[model samples]
Target: MSEHAPVEPGQVLPATELVRDRIARRWEGLNERVQAKVQSISGLDRTPEVRLIQQASSAGTVTKRVSWLRKAADHVHAGAAHLAACRKGCAHCCHIAVTISRAEAQVIARETGAKLNPKAGVFSMADSEDFGEAFKQATSGAVGKPCTFLTEGSCSIYAHRPLECRLLLNLDDDDLLCQLVEGSATNVPYLDARQHHVASVAILGQHQDYDDIRNWFPQGRANDTPSTQHKAD
Candidate 1:
């Protein structure tokens, strides 16, 4: 028997419940499709981690899966190296709003021993009115600030950077479009990031949120704090 039955012409419909159920079903369907696409990609046969993503159900497992997917996307981006204008020492695009999965953030924190500030006013796209609004809200205080991992105009965590950073490949001839202080460029090229993005989001669900890359590190490093000195002679 169906949980919901046909309603009469003048009957009060369970509109809110129906809408919520419909949205949930749609999300599940989309997640299934995204997983299928990731599984079908060539050269993933050699990647054991890709296979493990199917069995992932926990937060830690999902993070590992996302990390593997980011690496695979990096490989694909490298294959199209000729179409990209991005190079070392060109860090203009690093100033933009970059959304990342909770899993990715946790991985970065673990790797770098950085503390995460949950009250940094980061907003999730899932809760925003739209992508543009989400970007605006999440990056409110982070626009001109360089990424925390950027050192001397290069990414210090290049090997383990987030998926968003790995997939961004500027197609513009120069950095003019990326040099803009507000809004992203339209001509930037990127690998097909849909699979990884959707898969990670589906796995992370509401737990995922955006945070500025700069906020991940502790305010003061272990060496930055003043050490106690013995009484002077």
Candidate 2:
């Protein structure tokens, strides 16, 4: 049969149905072992510190220099490579209070058409009452709680996950991020502390405030409710 045959007049397909079909087809191409790996890591437990790392926004300006970012990009890319190999069901990163730059947020919203919950007020890195104070109290920047996006052991907006989300992999121990910075993994270079600090500051300034991205998210999703899974069958 021709791949691009015209459809019958007046026959309509629901967009959601089409999306599900596409999801299924994509998964079908993967080998069984690879597919199984994705599933295995999909719902791993979150460490309490992960949330802090997400919130620890940098408090400075970004130079936007390509060379500096280029150096950091390799580490991120290596980290992402490890992450992509993970199972579909593994969403431990989703459990953290993820923050994004204005650019990242815009891309995600545009791509996924997912709207942030209006109930949760905008989150800001400058808000002394929230992030600043939290920073003072906690050794790590995480919120010590699962992020609101997590539901039913999954991320509600998986397709539009931010850069940080795409970088996480199973650590096997609670202090993974810390270890990455301090460990001896040959392939994985330590992420430059200065670069991350500058990047965080740049993101916060671009948004004019941290709350800008928070304004996009919704609130009051059941804490333990897992997000609905979408994959080809």
Candidate 3:
């Protein structure tokens, strides 16, 4: 009965398909256990029309996607704005050291044409500084730094922005929602960060070997080759 219900013209759908799609893309590479999860989740796939609506909502449009996540985009933007407002032209977020997974780095490099210079792969935070100490410092002591994709005063690949960026929101100073509504604005509702993270992890975790973008690439050592040994004295 739930399978064939007639979808309304502009009605949004659940995110089961979004989960399924990602699974499909990375399925073969996943382990047997993860493959089983992927298959199980795929069984609950929603219609294509509804799936697109959810994507459109998560991207920015509130009126397009499923009901639950409609305001998600707005809230994320509001939060990001708070960190951005007083820090105008700050580029603080862009200055911190960041590590991207090989896959994600490949995506960014491919999209932006910014290659990981094999010769210039190493850069010291002390010498090759960008903005300031504050920007360089990790947020809440979290690992990874500013993304390599960040450049100048803005993002080069804003359209294909990261999931974190997509969910961030900014509230106006006068906007009472900043203080009044903790989650989701009346004009623009959004998902709580906890919920967002949980959902993302649950879905993405279904694919084995799919690493965490946050920790996929370490900022400093461990992955480096034996440089000193290879160098001539």
TM-score to true structure, per model:
0.60, 0.39, 0.33
Candidate 3 whole-model C-alpha lDDT, 0 to 1: 0.33
lDDT, model 2? 0.39
Highest TM-score scorer: 1
| Candidate 3 local lDDT, 6-50, one digit each (tens) | 332112234356533532443344345333433444453344424
Q: Name the candidate that leads on lDDT.
A: 1
lDDT (Cα, tens digit) per residue for candidate 1, span 91-183 = 655665566656677777676555666665356757756656766656665545666555555565665677677767654333333443233
Q: What order do you get sorting by TM-score, best first?
A: 1, 2, 3
The true-versus-predicted C-alpha distance at residue 19 of model 2, in Å, is 42
TM-score computed on alpha carbons, candidate 1: 0.60
User: Tens digit of lDDT per residue, candidate 2, span 1-233?
Assistant: 22223332112223355534543453353345344544565564433223323433331323223223323433443433443423444343343345555545544555555565433334445565676654333313232234455555566655444545544443221212211111121121222234454554553354343332334454522333434551100
Q: Using alpha carbons, what is the TM-score of model 3?
A: 0.33
Please list the residue runs of candidate 2 whose C-alpha ends up more than 4 Å from where it truly belongs after superposition.
Answer: 1-75, 78-88, 117-131, 134-152, 170-197, 203-207, 211-215, 219-233
